[model samples]
Target: MTSPQSVYRAVAREVNRASISAPATRSKTIVKNFRTIIESGGQSNTEHFDHDLANAVTFMKSQRMYKILLERYNPLHDMSAEEKVKATARRVGLDVPLRENSDEGQ
Candidate 1:
């Protein structure tokens, strides 16, 4: 069996290997700018509010795209067919029925 330390190291390595794209970097910058605006109570003009609103929308769209990509490329997709079915059933608050004997269905 793999040790817990090895598993954690592998996860850390994968996380480090995933480099941030330009758009993600921009999103972080936008979030930081918005946070600063909010902290400084600087919503003094309609144009400023509009610009901030646009930034917020852009950030939300990027967040949604990232979520879709993550779901599509999830490692859980590597599960066997039977395991997938069991996972789906469990997700919906149901359980796959257990068989008493492997040859019973035959």
Candidate 2:
């Protein structure tokens, strides 16, 4: 039977290892704490969790989601507003040669 303190430290150590890439480490920590709550094995819906901590965890999840979206996904996902305008200009017969790699292609 593992002690609560041991479990706590193990979670911190493991989550810290993953934190660098995830940036959602704090939310993961909250999840670990919540597991600790259930592991205490009290029978009840009587457990009242802290709202502020939950909110913090929720916000961190959102930030991590968006960070992943914009940083890892946005570049090739769609045109930027300026790029869209440039495309429109090209469609209207302006000199917007859209291929940035035209010179390299030769």
Candidate 3:
């Protein structure tokens, strides 16, 4: 039973965060669409609200995935291949087993 205001605030926060790296047009579009839904009273309709929420969730997921991929593949970082893999694994909630000869524990 989440309140509409709470949901709006939460989505707004995520939209702002995603917009930081998003292209200007794309960010504006997201904001515009969200505002349209809100202003149209879509939240009062369960189906409309669920559909728009799903779209927002999908957009956020893609934004996060893009950021993760960018970080993983960015050559500017000094991360080693194994370190990159370990980082990705950690992000996905899995642990990379330590090698016996690895110096990471030292």
Pairs that clash in candidate 1 = none
RMSD list, candidates in order: 16.4, 10.6, 11.8
Q: What order do candidates take by lDDT, descending?
A: 3, 1, 2
Backbone clash total for model 2 is 0
Off by over 4 Å in 3: 21-33, 74-106
TM-score for all models, in order of appearance: 0.31, 0.30, 0.44
The lDDT of each candidate is 0.56, 0.56, 0.70
Ranking by TM-score: 3, 1, 2
Write out the backbone clash pairs for model 3: none
User: Which structure is stronger by TM-score: 2 or 3?
Assistant: 3
Q: Over the stretch 1-106, how does candidate 3's per-residue lDDT look in tens digits?
A: 4455665666777787766475554546766666676666653777767666767767886887888788787743668888888878988999998669667668
| Candidate 2: residue 72 Cα off by (Å) | 3.2
What is the model-wide C-alpha lDDT for candidate 2?
0.56
The sequence of per-residue lDDT tens digits that candidate 1 reaches over residues 1-106 is: 3333343344333333343665445334444544555445433664565455555555555666776687797846768999998988998999999868878767
